[model samples]
Target: MRVAILAVQGAFIEHRKKLESLGAECIELRKKEDLEQPFDGLILPGGESTVQGKLLRELEMYDSLKEKIESGMPVLATCAGLILLAEHLSNDEHVYFGTLPVTVRRNAYGRQLGSFHTDAEVKGIGEVPMTFIRAPYIETADEQVQVLAHVDDRIVAVQYGAQIGLSFHPELDADSRIHEKFLGLIADCIKNNNCRKN
Candidate 1:
């Protein structure tokens, strides 16, 4: 399977390395031209949501990427990526993709010093390592969205259809289960012929 990692900004390289280790072809989506290639899934890594959103539009890749995602392309969005996909933000007025019916609170865990790591049982995936660095957590989700995992009563992971949004960075860990689970999602799409373009 091939996956496109948005490298415009943030911790994208780590995701690429993880996906690569799982035997998936990884592509970096940096410019609009990079979208020309066929990819089975997309990964929106952790980063500053506002900056990523601005760059996506300014680089003219926002519309096309949004279109693909809306067309049922499976996505694994982490940290700020969760912010990007949310339809609502608890503190911000701007919404990026607005594809997932979730409401997230940016920096809900305080600043960088608040960063932490822990092992949590992700529904359907068991316990896995989760690293949060100035991350945002989901405050509320539509009825259709499934809550995957939580920490200290705070929602940290959620799945809505073909998209999975996590408030923690899974790529920074040694475990590949999270990334593997994502590939399984893509594999399912392929088997069911539900993949968008590839």
Candidate 2:
């Protein structure tokens, strides 16, 4: 299996290393052409959404990624990556791609000093230590989406079809289960598609 990790200035290297350890071919995607290339799955690493959005626009990949994701390209987005996949804005006027049908409030957890780590019971992954740094929360989810985990009654992880959005950075931890689960999802998508073709 091959996975593309968006290397637009974030903790992408961490994610890439974790995914690679899972026995998958890892590719760092920097330019628009990278997104166009074939891959079993893609991961959008956490970073400043505004900055990443600008880069996406400059590379002319905003629309192309939107189209590819719609065609069942599985994506795993964390923190600022979650913002990139959000559909509803926080009213703070921060730019977003509005990809997933999720309502996000940027930095709803407070500032950098308010960063905290907690144990979240992600549905498929069980209990795992989650790192939250000025992370946003999923306030609302469309009917088609299924929430995976929550903390303090606030949604932190969600899955919408082929996409997984998280307010915490799973790659920051030593656990590779989350990354493995994602690969499984990508494999499932591919298998289903091949079955349809056959």
Q: Pick the candidate with the highest TM-score.
A: 1
- The CA lDDT of each predicted structure is 0.94, 0.84
TM-score of each: 0.98, 0.93
Scored by Cα lDDT, where does model 1 land? 0.94
Candidate 1 stretches with Cα past 4 Å from truth are none
RMSD per model, one decimal = 1.1, 2.6
- The TM-score of predicted model 2 comes to 0.93
Q: Can you write out model 2's per-residue Cα lDDT over 94-184, one digit (the tens) per residue?
A: 5556779988998887665358889979997899989988888999999889999999999999998889999999998887788888999
List model 1 lDDT by residue over 88-173, tens digit each.
99999999999999999998988654799999999998999999999899999999999999999999999999999999999999
